[model samples]
Target chain A: MVQPEQIKQWIEAGLDGARVTVVGDGHHFEAVIVSPAFDDKSMVQQHQLVYQVLGEKMKEEIHALSMRTLTPEQAAQQGE
Target chain B: MSVQDRIKEQIVSEKIMLYMKGTPQFPQCGFSGKTVQILQACGARFGAVDVLADPEIRQGIKDYSNWPTIPQLYINGEFIGGCDIITELYQKGELQKMVMAAQG
Candidate 1:
């Protein structure tokens, strides 16, 4: 039963210049993360970066997580 | 053979492979169900493995791809991400392109 804020904090703490928003009911979470680290990575790699931040929690604490990873540029582009 | 090797063989055997929670017709999880819908929408002929049915694969797959969730997609032996990424790619029409290219 992990809180969304905790997940957000974990990602923010691990990633540099990351803006993370997570919403969930303790188990299944949906996260939208924008970071400079995602700049040149593929979608799989981008998610992997976030997964690394979550670490072992992904195996036990977080039962499910659906995420949208974006570079700051891509996030801004989505605004248009 | 190691579980990783078995997973590797499975991926290469099918151009499109989905390691999901259940069968496509009876997906056990919402994420897995949604993934099946997206693949069906793309008219993709994919091989599906029910992670829930096999504990070894359920655990092995996560380690195999370093992906922490179910409903993982693989196209032409490449990990394409899970349900969220799959839906995003399908919405962007990239998945259709990949499926078409895979078929040819």
Candidate 2:
């Protein structure tokens, strides 16, 4: 049972200037990550950056992760 | 042909393709089921590959797309994304436009 903060920390550490919010019940997790690094990257590429942060933890600890990744501007414009 | 070659061939042949955990009629994973749902909503004429039935293509796809997950969608030979991205796109109504454009 991984803590939400753990996931958030990993993501924040991975992406510079990233704002990560994570909510989950152990095996399943959902995340909303806003990052400047995501700017100009395709959706696939944005998700790839998140996956890189979790590394083997994604394959091991997390059963499933559903995430919404966005650029800071997109997040702000959406008033999120 | 190698699995990679076959996967590439499949991608090239199908305008809208889904590499999923189970057949669209009976999707094994929630993600795959949801993805198929979106494609159906788009009224997309898509070809689906059940990864569970072909372990070679299943593992090979991860390498092919460099994405770790099933229920991957490819439109016009381009890797769109997995379930979460698809869900988000559907919510924003971008998926409909993309799907329609792919076939148009």
Q: What DockQ do the predictions score, one after another?
A: 0.88, 0.73
- Write one digit per residue (lDDT tens) for candidate 1, span B49-100: 9999889999999998988889889988998988889999999999999999
Q: What TM-score does candidate 1 reach?
A: 0.95
The DockQ value obtained for model 2 is 0.73
lDDT of 2 at A7: 94
Each prediction's interface RMSD?
Answer: 0.9, 0.7
In the range A1-80, model 2's lDDT, one tens digit per residue, is 79889999999998999999999999889999999999999999999999988888987888889999989899989876
Docking level for model 2: medium
lDDT of 1 by residue, A1-76 (tens): 6999999999999999999999999978989999999999999999999999989988889899989998999999
Complex DockQ, candidate 1: 0.88
What is candidate 2's TM-score for chain A? 0.97
